[model samples]
Target chain A: MIIIAILIGCIVGALIGINAPVIPYTYSTFLAIAVVAALDSVFGGITSVLKKNFDLTIFISGFFCNSILSIALTYLGQKLNLDIYLAALVVFVGRMFTNLTIIRRYYIEKWTSKIEKDDKELQQ
Target chain B: MKIKIKKEKLVMSITIGIACFALMLVMFMQFNMVKQTDITGIETMRESELRLELSSWNEKYNELNTIYQETVGKSEEYKNERESYEKTYELLSKELEQLNKALGKTDVEGEGIVIQLTDKAGTQLSEDVKVKRITEEDLLIIVNQLFAAGAEAISINGHRVISTTSIFSIGEEFLKVNGERIVEPYVINAIGNPDYLKSTVSGKGGHVDALKELGHETSVDINKNIKIEKYEKELHTKYID
Candidate 1:
């Protein structure tokens, strides 16, 4: 699942890059990505607060990673003189790669095994 | 174990499907508006093209109109020039004939009278006391009085006075008559009704009195039976059109 997400991100980025100048909703695409990233970060924070196991390091790292990604994307736009849409899509691919490789491996494996078992039973 | 779809899932699915359908409807309306805009843009381009053509025609028409007016103005100017030239030619021809008669040898007899005016030497000067010399203005006044009295031909100090001539001072010690320089004690000779010219000069309130007031003497001599010589007038300046 993680690998599939990275592949999907790459495909989305390439497509957006190819249609760079023509995409009218490029701004909205970045907005949507930002909204989802913020929501995920907030939910994770809330869960940690409720459990009372909020290691300052873990809490800070999780938020910092996403914040760094957002800041890095903006920095890339300024440095490369890129359109905001192209920059956001490039950063999205980078985040997807990071997620599938290390961040979401445990969660994706756990969910994939369960999905496979369910599929086998349905087939049977 | 078999899983069944619940009521909440069914309601959520219906909500998502309705939202997607509404989004599609908006996209369709947007595409239709874009098409309408394209059509209107074509119409506007056609209208602009027509306006440009009309403006070109207007510019061309105005250019032609100006040309026509300038041509008419030039024609009127040429006509006035031609008419004036003809009138000047007639006047000059008459002057030439008179000059030829005056200069040409003539067995054919015609009558002319002469009047001579001489100033007394060293008279009682006027209040100005400026040597009491005769002036060009005085000669012009006497010549004009002779012509007014119907004198046909006139001369002053060997220079003939024509229809157009001016007698004036050029510098301190020199005066010009018909543009020729001369000195003082001017002798004026004119041919016409000598008796009439003599009366006109000696008449009451005449140039004779005016000259006397300016401290210069004047006289009129009539030569009726004298064998007069005719001479041609040589014009040195073009004074008239």
Candidate 2:
């Protein structure tokens, strides 16, 4: 059921995205910020799940709040003639990388331990 | 315990799906934007591309020029329509004013004369001679004479004399003009040429002289300004279709 739901949601979202109006390039900066923030939140959610400390409320709230705050900052930056969105982009991307590394290291260690146990049983 | 775990997993999956959906949507939108608009510096363009850009801009300018001219024409048409509407408004207002004047619907003033008629004093007459008090018939006769003398407007005892006016005796003690009881002194204001009005009312062989002969108090004053009030009642016509 869960896999089917995700597949449906993704397909529907893709369809809607294809039909969606193309935003002007000037305001595309805000979209970029939002996309980066959401991606960072997703990676963070996975890392928390691996560490057994996941909270759905915290994950969703972080996702939305980060996006909104980043957009606001981008607007202020434009008024000040500065590229402040770039700074936000860097932070979100950096956090995403750290989360990815944590997830990768966790799965790799789990797999290696499982393989060693299986080899000992085989020898016995 | 297994059911609870399944429910938790279902919740988590839905949340994850929503997040995935959002990511896909945003990414696709960005993809579309990137595909549609080429973000390149103007100085890096080739000569041929620059000429094509210039031609497209000129075409856009021509389209915009036609639109601007069409808007200007529409504005001029609206201005003319407003002017004509204003002219019609002015004409209707003037017509309303004139109709009101002719219908005795408004107070009027001009060079005219005031005729005041009072009952004969008891002391001035002998005991054998009976005083003929001023009656409504005498008023009607005098009003007719004033209108005959080209009086534009007239009033008796402050009651406007319109086309529907009535002058008659109610009882032995009171006379009615325009349905209101008028007493001893009747003030008649007539708006017209003062000399003509005076000559018609108080002139020799006029109704005023006849009243004086009947021992009634009569006086006519030529005035430069005499105001006659409008009729108090609303004029209605049910018979006219």
Instruction: Give the TM-score of each candidate.
Output: 0.32, 0.49
- Candidate 2 at residue B36, lDDT? 67
Whole-model lDDT for model 1 versus the true structure? Answer: 0.57
The candidate scoring highest on TM-score is: 2
**Per-residue lDDT of B1-241 in model 1, one digit per residue for the tens?**
1234455444434433333333333333334434444655443554347668789999999999999999999999999999999999999998987666554322223234444444543564565455355666777888889889886666677666665567898765667876778765566666677678778876786786667666565555667543433333454556756
TM-score of chain A of 1: 0.32
Point out where model 1 deviates above 4 Å.
A1-124, B1-99, B102-131, B225-241
What residue runs in model 2 are displaced by over 4 Å at the alpha carbon? Answer: A1-124, B1-51, B121-128
Which lDDT value does model 2 have at B91? Answer: 96
What is candidate 2's lDDT per residue for B101-190, written digit by digit as tens?
777999988889999888874535776877777778888999999999999889998999999999999777788877888887889999
Residue B82 displacement (Å), model 1: 33
lDDT of 2 by residue, A1-124 (tens): 7678679778877887887899776677788889899889989988998999989889988988898999999999888878788899999999999999999999999999999999999999
- Against the hidden true structure, what lDDT does model 2 obtain? 0.86
Candidate 2 differs from the real structure by a C-alpha RMSD in angstroms, to one decimal, of 18.9
Candidate 1 backbone clash number: 4
lDDT per residue for candidate 1 within A52-124, as digits (tens), equals 6544445445544654566467556646755453555555555545544543565677789999999999999
